[model samples]
Target chain A: MAKHEHKLEIFRGYLKFKSNVQKIWGVLIFLSIVTAIEVALGILKPPILMNYFLGLKLINWIFIILTIVKAYYITWDFMHVRDEKPFLKNTIILPLLILIPFLLFILLWEGSYIFDVMLDGLKEWDFDIY
Target chain B: MQASTLTKTKQKTWGGGGVKPLDAAYGKLMMWFFIVSDALTFSGFLVAYGFSRFKNIDSWPIADEVFHHFPFLHGVDAPMYYVALMTFILIFSSVTMVLAVDAGHNNDKNRVAFYMLLTIIGGAVFVGSQAWEWKNFIKGEYGAVEIQNGEILQFYDIKKDKRIPIDDFAVLQSQERVTHDDNVGIWYQSEAKLPEITLSEVMEGFKTNSAITVRVEELNDKGQKIILSREDAENKLSSATRVVKGANLIRNEYGNPLFADFFFFITGFHGFHVFSGVVINIIIFINVLLGTYERRGHYDMVEKVGLYWHFVDLVWVFVFTFFYLV
Candidate 1:
C-alpha cells in the first residue's frame, strides 16, 4: 500500500512538471511561427490573391487577421488567461466586444457621408482656386 | 457555550485574503484593463481618420503613390517596402517579448534578461526608423507655386498636358509687398506673395507652344484624368489662368497637402506613442537588470511591461494598415 502511494505521487509530480513546460513552450512557438508567416506573406504580397477579393486587397485583411491572432494569443496564453476562469475572461473581453464594433460603425457611417460631400459638391465648385 | 461562541465569531470574521475576484494575479489584471483603455484611445483616432478619408473619397490622394520612397535608390517608385520593414521589426520585438515571458516561466533568469534587452533595442530601432520617415514627409517635395492667399496652384501646361515646375515659367516677385509688421509699420500684417507665373503662364506658353496638355482632377468616362489637348487647354488656360491663386487644394508637385496633414498627424501621433513606449521600456529594462523583480521570486513585473510593449505593436499594425496599405 505504501509503495503504491509513492508511485502515484511520483507520477503526478512528473505530469504536472511536463504540463507546465508544454504550456509555456506551446505559446512561444505558436507566436513565433505565426509572426514569421505574416512577414513572409507581407513581403510576397501576391497580386493574384489580392485581386480575388472584391476590391478588397489581400494584404490588408491578412495584416488585420494576423494582428488579431497575435493579440488573442498574447492576451490568452502569455498573459496566462488560459488558467483564468471563464467569468474573469468575460470581464476583460466583454467591454471591448461591445465598444469596438460600435466605434467602427460610427466611423464607417460618418466616413461615407464625408466621401459623398467631397465627391458630389467640391468637385463641381466653380470658384477659381488658382 | 462561551468558548464555542468565541470560536464561531473567529470563523465568521471575513477572510478578506482568500481568492480575489477575477482570479488573476493583480499585475496581470491591471495590465489587461490598461490595454482595454489604450485600445479604445487608438480606435477613436482611427475612426476619426476613417471619417476624414470617407469625407474626401474622390480627391483623397491614393496612398500608394505618396509613400514611394525606396532607401538608397532615389526616384525608384518603391511603395510599402519601408513600412513593411517597420512592421517586421515590431513583430520580431513581440516575439522576443514572448520568449522573455517563456524564460521567466522556466525560471531562466539570464535568458529572460537577454531577451528583454533585445526587445528594448528593437523598439528603439523602430522609433528611429519612424523619425527618418517623418523627416522625409516634412521636407516638401518638388516645391509648388505659392499664391497671395497661401493657396497653391500647380501648373499643368495644356500643350504638353503635364505638370510643370514653378521654375519652368519666368516668375517675378511682387514689388508692393503687403508689409504690416511692426518693423514695416505700426500694424504689421506680412504681405502674402502670389505666384507671378500663375496658371496662365502655362496656358499662354501652350498657346504659343503647341506641345502643352492640361489634366484636371475630373476623371473621364474611362476613369482617367481628363486631358485637354493643346488647343483646348490653351483656350481654357487663357480664360481661367487669369484668376489669382487661391490655395493649392488639389494635387501638386509636393504631392497633396491632405496627405501632408494626415502623414504629420497620424504618424506623428503613433511615433509619440512609440517614443513614450521606448522610454517606459527603458525604465523597466533598468529595473529588470537591477534585480527588482528577481528579488520578488516572481517576474510578474516583466510580464506587465510586456503587455504594454505588445500593445504598442498591436497599434502599429493598424497604423501600418491605414497609413500604408489602405
Candidate 2:
C-alpha cells in the first residue's frame, strides 16, 4: 500500500489551508462568486456585451469562459482531481477535450448548411401542406 | 524447487499486473471511465440540439421567454432565475459530496454521514425543481395557433409588451365539440386532448380585438421575434388550422417543435442521472452509518460514489450553459 497525499493548497498556493474544512469553504466561496457573476450577466444581458464577436455575442463568450472556469474548479478542487496522479487526470480529460470540439464543429456546420437549403436555396419548394 | 517453478509460471501468466498505474483504486478508476463515457453520451445529445437550433435559428424559441416562471410568483416573469437557483443547489451538493470524501479521508465517520445527508437533500431539491419546470413547460402560459404551413403564431398586446393568453381574448363558442376518445376514434388510436379554445373561436376573437397583434416565429436583425403587420396577421390567421396550447413531443406553442423535443430528451436524461446519483448516495450513506467502511479500514466506497456525484454536477454545468445561458 502507498501513502496518499492530499493537496491542501489552492489559488496557486496563495490561499493555503492547514485543514481540509477551510479549503472546502474556500473553493465554495470561489465557485459561488463565479456563479453569481454568470447569473447577473444572464439577467442583465447588457447591450454592450450583446455586440457580436467571433460570430457570437460577447456576453455569450463570457458565459462560456466563466462556465469553463467553474468546471475546472469543480473538477480540480471539489472532485480532488488535483490530488490524482498526472496519468489519471489526463486519462479522464483528454478524450472529452478531443471529442467535444469535433462534435461541435460538425453539428454547427451541417445545421447552417441545412438552414441555407431550406430557407434560401430551395424557395420554390412549397412548405404549406396541412 | 516446486514452489520456485510455480512462482515463475505465475509471473509469466500474470505479467506482474497488480501495480496500480495511476495509484487510483480499481473502483475509482472504473467510475472515471463510466463518467467519461456518460459525458460523451450527453455531449452527443447536446450537439444534436445545437444542430436543430442552428437549422431553425430564425424561428427558434427564446429560452428567456419560455422559461420565465418562478415558484410562488404567479404571473411574474422571472427568466433564468429558478434555473440559476437549481444550478447552485447542484453545485453546492457537489461541494458537500467532496466534503464527505474529505471526511472519509480523515477517518471521520460522523462528518461523512452528515455531509452525505446534505448532498442527498440537495439532489432531491434539484430534481423536484426540474419536475416543476417540466410541468410549466408542458402547461404553457400563452397558447398559439398553428397555421397550415406548420408555423406557430403567438399573440402579444402592443401596449403591455407581454404575451396575452388566448383565454384572455378568445370568444367562447356555443357550439359543442367533443374530444376524440378511444371509443370515438379507432380503438387503438386516440387523439391528444383538444385545446380549450377552437381555431374558429380564436379567429373570431382576434378579428374583434384590434389591440392584439401576431408575433411570428421569425427573428429580425436584432434577434427578437418579428411582429407581423395587421394585414399580415389577418392573412396568416386565415390559414390557421389547429390550436396548440402547450408543448409536447410532436408540437409546441413555441416556434420550433425540435426545441421542445430536445428539451425533453436532454434534460430528462440528465434528471435521470441526478436521480440515480441520489439513490446511490443514500445507499452509501447507509453503509457509512452501518460502519461498513470503518470496519474495512478504508472508506473507498464513499470516495467512488463522490466521483459519480461530482460528475453529475459537472454535466449540469454544461447543460446550464448550453440550454439556458447560451
Candidate 3:
C-alpha cells in the first residue's frame, strides 16, 4: 500500500492545525465567509458595481472572482489537493488551463455571430424557417 | 514474482513504466481526470447559456422576478432567498463530507459513519428543495400572453408595483374548453394541455381594469422591463395569439423560451449530479457500517468520494453565481 500523509496547515500557515479535524473546521469557516460575502453582494447589488466594466457588469466580475476563490479553497483544502504531489497537480490542472479558454472563446464568438445573423441578416433575407 | 525479474522487465519497458508516475494511487488519479472532464462538460453548458443570454440581452427575463417564491411565504417577494439557502445546504454537505474523509484518515469509524450520514441527509434535502423550486417555476405565479411575434406580455399594477395574476382579473366564461387528445386528434398529433384562461377573456378583463398595464419582456436603458402605456398596451394586446400559463420547452410565461430551456437543462443536469452523489454516499455509508475500510487499514475510498462531493459543491458555486446572482 502507498504511504499516506495529510496536510495539517492551511491559509499559508496563518492557521496551523495539529490534526485533520481542526483543518477541516478551518477550511469550512473560510468557505462560509466567502459564501456569505457573495450572497450579500448579490442582494445589495450596489449602483457603483452595477456600472459596466469590460463590456460586463462590475458586479458580475466580482461574482466570478469570488467564485474562483471558493473553487480554489474547495479543491485545495476539501479535496486535499494541497497534500498531493506536484506532478499530480500539474497533470490535472494544465490541460484545463489550456482547453477552457479555447472553448470559451470559440463558443462565445460563434454565439454572437449567430445573434448578429438573427438580428440583421434574417430581417434582410426573411427566410420562412421558424 | 521475484524482485530481480520484475526489475529486469521494468527496465526494458520504456524507462521503467511499472512505477506509478505521480506517486498517486490509480483510483485517485482516475477520479481527478474524471472531474476535469466533467468540469469541461458543465462549462460547455454554461457558456452556451451565456451565448443565448447575450443574444437576447434586451429581452432576457429578470431572474429575480422569475424565481421569487419562498416555501411558506406565498405572495411575498423573496428573491434569491431560497436559492441562497439551497446553496448553503449543499456547501454544508461538502463540509460534512470532508470531515468524514478526515475522520477516515484517522481510522475513526464512528465519526466517519456519522458525518457520512449527515452528508447524505444534506444532499437529499438539496435535491428535494430543487424539486420544489422546479415546481414553482413550472407552475408560474402570473400567466402571460404570447404575442404573434413570440414575445411575452405580463401584467402589472401601476400603483402597487406588483404583478397581477390572470386568475385575479380574468372573468371566467362559460365557453366549453376542449383539450386535444390522441383519441380526438389525428394519429400521433396530440396537443399540449390548454392554458387556464382564453385570450379574449384576458383582453376583455384588461379593457375593464383601468389600473392595469402591460409589461413587455424588453428592458429599457434603465435596465428595467419596459411597461407599455394604456394605449400602447392595448395595441400590443391586439397581436396576442396564445395564452401561456407556465414554462415548458416550447413556450414560457417568462420572456425568451430559451431562458427557461437553459434553466431546466443546466439546473436539471446539476440536480442529477447531486442525486447520484447521494446514492454513491449511501453505498459508501453502508460499507462504512460494514467496517470495510477498517479492514483495509485505510479509507481511500471515502476520500475519493469526498473529492466528488466537493466538486459538486464547487460547480454549484459557479451555477449559483451565474443563474441567480449575476
Chain A TM-scores for all candidates read 0.72, 0.89, 0.84
Q: Candidate 3 overall Cα lDDT vs. reference?
A: 0.85
TM-score of each: 0.70, 0.93, 0.91
Clashes of each: 21, 0, 0
Fnat, model 2, is: 0.83
Report how far off residue A20 is in candidate 1 (Å). 9.5
Displacement of the residue B258 alpha carbon in candidate 2, Å = 0.8
TM-score, cand. 3 vs. native: 0.91
In order, the Cα lDDT scores of the candidates are: 0.61, 0.87, 0.85
Q: Which of candidates 1 and 3 reaches a greater lDDT? A: 3
Model 2: per-residue Cα lDDT at residue B268: 96
Measured by DockQ, the strongest candidate is 2
Q: What DockQ does predicted model 3 obtain?
A: 0.57
Report the C-alpha lDDT of model 1 over B1-326, residue by residue, as the tens digit: 11111132354323234444565555567678888898888878777777676655444555554466767978676777777778778767877886787666665688888988899889899988888776665443433443343333344655454555444553344355343445675565555444455554444454554544555444453324455565655444443523332223342344335655666677777788778877877887786787755654556567677878877887887787677665
When sorted by DockQ, best at the front, the candidate numbers are 2, 3, 1
Model 1 TM-score (2 dp): 0.70
Among all windows of ten consecutive residues in candidate 3 chain B, which has the lowest summed lDDT? Answer: B1-10
lDDT tens digits, residue span B1-326, model 3: 11112132343213233455577655677789899999999998998888888787777898888898889898888888899899989989998998898788789999999999999999999999999999998988899998998889999887787789887888778778788788875685778777778888888889889888999988998678999888999888998998889899999998899989999999999999999999999999999999877866678789889989999998898899889888
TM per candidate, chain B: 0.72, 0.92, 0.92
Share of native interface contacts present in candidate 3: 0.69
